[model samples]
Target: MSRLYVILDVFADKALAGNPLAVVLDASGLDAAAMQRIAREFNLSETVFLLPPEDEDRKARVRIFTPQRELPFAGHPTVGAAALLGLMEAMAGKGREATFEIEEAVGAIACRTVASGKRAGRATFDLPRLPQPSGAAPDAAAVAAALGLAPGDVGFEGHAPSRFDAGNAFCFVPLAGLDALARAAADPGRWRTAFGGDLGAFLYTRETADPALAFRARMLSPGIGEDPATGSAAAAFAGAVMTFDRPADGEHLLRIGQGYEMGRPSVIELGLVVRDGALSAASIGGAAVVVAEGTLFLP
Candidate 1:
């Protein structure tokens, strides 16, 4: 059994700034139960398991898990997995840079590797651009009650609460100020009851702190207990906002800064194009760095 495990910092240009994830290579021998146990042992936001790719064009077969459950796709896990693969290839005497794809639960994705003394893999996946968004201005009363804010305090001229997805789901809510967002606390019961499952919530607070960045978002899943950063939700959010807002002309490239409150302080860059009142494409890519490499031994 291969005992190599790699940890990566995703969405941050430098190590230690972004979300840290564990990637276990050669996980073919581990069962589903063992995978969950391994994820729990890591106790990070998420952990990725990589097996030999089913297709030659693909790089690896990826399975992502939180301590609670397995996920079809996730952001940091995707980046983390690719970084691990690139490092593995280099150590095996491969060349400097490479391009590969990972066959994940979401499907095959393109991953490009660049060499900067160390292997850093950057992967971009085509998230199913939902033609129509699931959005309706939630009754102001219910929305305000849920957020513990007055009806007038919550709003957006171009957007409303919506559910968007690449591989995971995001219930997007926009708020007035970071203070309002910081004060917003969710009861665990409300999550399963309102969301129908323990899934993703993309909550954004308009930031006066930095006008250039646009906003700060806090993604929460009571199911996982805590997540420093979330990549899947970030993509879903960029897609949702673009789909719902059909403008005459122009593009919205949103910079989402999250994890500050948690002290990790991740910065995510996302863009979506809208034209003739329709959504076109969603692009989310970020930098990653490998922080540590070690072994996890199981008997």
Candidate 2:
């Protein structure tokens, strides 16, 4: 059997700068094991399989997978799939902007997309669930050892190691500066001790390469040593920002730059709606470009 798939650079500032994602449109008959195999075959950070929505009112049901396992919800896949669907409609003489719901393992996700060009688009989605502390995070010294950094280099401005989960869980590590962020590399043997999972650590710093951006970050897991961009982490990071920044009640926007250390610079826009010193809503938005399309054949 042959299935249609689209490859996209999601959350990119340009053509190839962001995280790459593969969207399989003809996933009617694929099973869980098959999807995992396909994700491994693509070898990208994640692959999205678009199936008929369980609810007719929704647009689609998207299944997200890493080479390792399935995810209930993911940031880049949601953005990329939404943008691609909207762009496809526009290319077929339909409208430019669309609002739809996507059903995932996590829940129904609300997404909006605007076509930017023939092959480019932008997407934003409401947070299905607000981030909350997952559990106790390891101490600064333990986190520092996992990242091969000194304990003093592990934290900044009272921002220490913390764990949170929006859809997926991640340990957020704040470094002292961009230099410390750049110097971070997961010590394979010690990583599991610190984060306790494959999707382990999200390291960030207040310092950024782009002066206009709010922060710089890097995501490191066990199998995937470093991720170019991590939307799920960013979604969960809302908790961190809200906890520390204590912004005045209103809508606020933040830009996070990532993947520079690996040469794939990507930008992620995060929006927070705070009211009464509490978070009312959060959003993640970014640009995506359709890079390639092809058919997948299986025996």
Candidate 3:
């Protein structure tokens, strides 16, 4: 048997930048084990399998997987899949813009996609779940040690270590500046002590490589190493932003810079809607470029 798949660079307008995702089209026959194996074969940050929607009203059912495990929800995959689907529709002479729903392990995600001719597109999805504190994070000193930074480089202003989940969880760590962020690296020996057993650490700084961006970030994990762009982490970080920044009751837009150090610079657009000083809604948006398409053979 064979499957159709497309490789895309999510959060990037160009090829070979941002977080690369492999999207398997019409993955109805494959089981979870097979999906996992295929994900490992692709060996990208994440791979998504598109199946027929259980609810006919939805556009598709999306299953996201890392090299090691399946994820309930993932940001880049969702964005990339939506963009690709939109491009397919456009090429079929349907339309350039589309609004649809995609079912994931977490729930139904509402997506809006704008196709750019044949090669690239932008997608935005409303978060099915709001960000919530998952658990207590390790102290700043321990986190600093795990990231190979001094204790003093751990936080900035009112930010400290915290855990949040918007389907996927991450330990959000705020660094003092870009200098500390640049120096930070995950030390395997100390990683578990700081972020616990499964949570990856999302290190961020107010200083960005691009001054136009609101923040600079890096995602490091024992399993995945460094991710060029992390949409789920950006989604979860909304909780930390609300707690610390406390934006007035209105819609706010933030641009995050990531992957510069890895030479695949990327940008993530996060929109937060606040009401009465509380986060009411949030969305993640980014551009994805289709880089390659191929057939995958399977037994």
Candidate 4:
């Protein structure tokens, strides 16, 4: 059988910049194993399978997959898939700023998209769940060892190590500077010591390469070496930031710069609504461009 698919660049401000995502449009008959295989074949950080929504009220059902396994939820895939869907609707004469719902492993996700008048569009989604502490984070030394950095190179602005999960769990490691962020590399031997298993390690620093950005970050995992822009991590980080920074009640925004090391510099916009020093809500937003559309031959 053949399946229709679209390739998109998520969180990108320009073509060829940002995380690449492959969205399978006609994914009704494909099994979970087949989806994983397709994701592997694409060799990107993630792929999305768009199926008919199980719930009539939802716009679509999306399943996200890494090369190795299917994720309950993912950032770029959601944003990319939502943008593609919105663009399709626009081409069909639908108006801009469409609000829709996507059913995922994490439950129902509310998404809003605005057509950019270009080949791309912008997407924002309210987090299905608020982030909370997942587990005790490894000490800075252990995390540094896992990331191939010195203990002294770890930590800045009093932001130590922490673990948080919004929809996905991530070990947040705060680095001292951009130099430390740039030098980070995964050491398989120390990976277990840091995260207790092969888990997503989010390395970030306040010293951003771009003056306009609030932070510089990189996501390192087992199958996906390093993610250019990571939305899920940013979502969870918002929770951690709210916990640590405890910003005054109201809306706070953060512009994250990522993927520069891989040459696919990307931007992720995070919005947080805090009330009485607690995070009441959070949103993730970014731009996605439909880079290619084709058919996928599958067994």
Error of 2 at 270 (Å): 1.1
- Per-candidate TM-scores read 0.85, 0.96, 0.98, 0.96
lDDT of 2 by residue, 75-162 (tens): 9999999999889878988899998898999999899999989989999999999999988876889889988899899877878888
What candidate 2 gets wrong by more than 4 Å, as runs, is 196-199
- Residues 35-135 of candidate 4 have per-residue lDDT tens digits of 89999999898999999999898899999998988999988899999998898888888886699999999999999999886468999999998899998
Candidate 2 steric clashes? 0
* Best-fitting candidate, scored by TM-score: 3
Candidates 3 and 4 compared: the better one by TM-score is 3
- Pairs that collide in candidate 2 are none
Give the per-residue lDDT of model 3 (tens digit) for 1-299.
Answer: 88899999999999989989999998998899999999999999899999999999999999999998999999999999999989988898889999999999999999999998698999999999999999886789999998889999988888989999998899999999999989998889988887877588989999885778999999998777899999999999999999888999999999999999899999999999999989999999999999999999888
The Cα local distance difference test for each model comes to: 0.70, 0.90, 0.92, 0.89
Q: What TM-score number comes out for model 1?
A: 0.85
RMSD of each: 3.0, 1.3, 1.0, 1.3
Q: CA shift at 120, candidate 4, in angstroms?
A: 0.4
Predicted structure 4, TM vs. truth: 0.96
Q: Please list the residue runs of candidate 1 whose C-alpha ends up more than 4 Å from where it truly belongs after superposition.
A: 87-97, 117-123, 128-138, 189-198, 247-252, 273-277
